[model samples]
Target: MFEIKDNHLAAGDLLAEALAKVPGIRHVKEVNDLSDIDKPTATPCLFYLYYGDQLTDAANAGANMQLKQTWLVVLAERKGSKQAGTNITATIRAIAGKMTGGAGPWQRVNTPIKPKYTNGHAFYPLAFTCQMRFKGALK
Candidate 1:
């Protein structure tokens, strides 16, 4: 059997690394809450969280497992500047481009959500999913 925690960490790390390379993204982290995000330091940042998982298939009397895991990535940028919208759009496309080729194990499951403007910030959420398959018994 495979360790789920390790897989989760690897997947999250992979995404974080990829997003970090995107232009205009200054910070990338796994966040528990959006309300507490610091706009100044983390603006033009990407925050991701593991949403949930589902078992899609199983075989070999439980020795093999196929699971689908989902993650949510939020892009936060400071609003007010005329280029804020343009920057957001560029970042979105860059992110989508990164996801288009497929990372180690993660895939962009759906289109990014519309940006929500509030409190001098614009937030765009993107969803990604991955399929994890574990076969054989643990050592």
Candidate 2:
């Protein structure tokens, strides 16, 4: 059998699994638009995954092509209390450590720790750039 695997989607699945383990993260899902961001009903943290820098090539004897891409893990924490948002971001940092040096396949990059303020709310964002390699082909 033959198959075309999506490296970016695979990386995202791995990242989402890693984040679900963290207690402070309430909701996690792939995000395309920022205006409709909604917090998790069970928790205060909302996460969105965006993919960028996708590159692929098909230059081999077989019908398969090389694939690589980047994933952005954006975290938005609502500040219900004075220290609520702080606690959420701290958990995000720890998740980064696990993704970069732990058992995850993705490598973490340098991103700003500053929180963007809008509508009287605090939004913390973190992005992980993952370089993945795979062979993909369409039938």
Candidate 3:
């Protein structure tokens, strides 16, 4: 998942498009339901990645790049439990690399709070943290 200024689904969608190269990512989904009392306020922007073997393939392709701090969400299916953690971390790094075109002196903005995972039972989701700086409205 890509971090957008607003934390909205649109941003997540855009991120999905930008990260189209990732393999095994069967699909990207926007989750807006906040019924969980423990759930944090939904960022105006966010996306969840549904990954598979293809995701591994895609991540391996981008392993050789340098990426700056970036936000991402990795959702592994129940069956793919074995590789969930590693795949998520690697995929985020790969997406960040691809988004920045493998080169960046991107200014970093430390998030006041660390991004974390929620709905731990089956989803196995993890959120990302990245430094953000802004001068204009993020599209």
The prediction achieving the highest lDDT against the true structure is: 1
> Arrange candidates by lDDT, highest first: which order?
1, 2, 3
Better of 1 and 3 by lDDT: 1
Alpha-carbon RMSD of each model: 4.1, 5.1, 13.3
The positional error of residue 51 in candidate 3, measured at the CA in angstroms, is 21
Please list the C-alpha lDDT of all candidates, in the order they appear: 0.65, 0.54, 0.38
What digit string (tens of lDDT, one per residue) describes model 3 on residues 11-125? 3444555445455555554444322323323221224432211121123345422222333353434443565555555555545434342223222233233334455323434
How far in Å is the alpha carbon of 95 misplaced in model 1? 5.6
> How many residue pairs clash in each candidate at the backbone level?
1, 0, 10
- Tens-digit lDDT track of model 2 for 1-139: 1122543355556666777666666667766765555444444555656556444555555455444445555555444546565655665565554553223435465553456665546666666655444454545
**Alpha-carbon runs more than 4 Å astray in model 3:** 1-10, 34-72, 97-121, 129-139
The C-alpha stretches of model 2 lying farther than 4 A from their native spots are: 1-8, 38-43, 54-68, 84-90, 97-103, 112-114, 137-139
**Model 1, which residues run further than 4 Å from truth?**
1-7, 38-40, 80-105, 111-115, 135-139
TM-score of candidate 1 relative to the true fold: 0.70
